[model samples]
Target: AGHSITTIEGLEKDNKLHPVQEAFVKEQAAQCGFCTNGLVMCAVSLLKINPDPDDQEIRDGLQRCLCRCGTQSRAIRAIKRVIG
Candidate 1:
């Protein structure tokens, strides 16, 4: 029960991927592409607080962000690289 929802199209404009979006593509993550945007947003928030998050920290961060395609593993990898 969140207050707002963000999407991939909303995350980018003028052909520029946000930092998290760039990280997502750079990591070769995202399968169905449904959760890509929200995942990226979550990544952004997480990185804002902890620029260097470990594996478990990432997994814990994304716990509530769900994807129908289940690309969690790939997303985690992307977040890790971006944070690092």
Candidate 2:
């Protein structure tokens, strides 16, 4: 277990949106919503280590995440939008 972790709820502060959140909203990346949090967390972690990952890299990084809403491609685009 990690001593520190950032949940989806932890991504915002001071009435401002986190970059990832802005990207997601702008890209309309979420659907149904159940998997949004997990996917966001995965993207956050990936960005921390690889700020400019390619699309396939992003997909590989988030392979464990399941988005029943069919927002996988949109979510990956959102992360790219934020990092670029």
Residue runs of model 2 more than 4 Å from their true location after superposition = none
Query: What lDDT tens digits, residue by residue, belong to model 2 across residues 1-84?
Result: 669877788989998888988898999988888888888888888998998999888999889887778999998889989878
Residue 14 local lDDT, model 2: 90
- Candidate lDDT scores, in order, read 0.79, 0.87
Which candidate has the top score in TM-score? 2
Q: Which portions of model 1 miss their true places by more than 4 Å?
A: 1-15
lDDT of 1 by residue, 5-80 (tens): 5565776878898778887888777788777767787887788788888898888888878787878888998887
lDDT score of model 1?
0.79
Number of the predicted model whose lDDT against the real structure is largest? 2
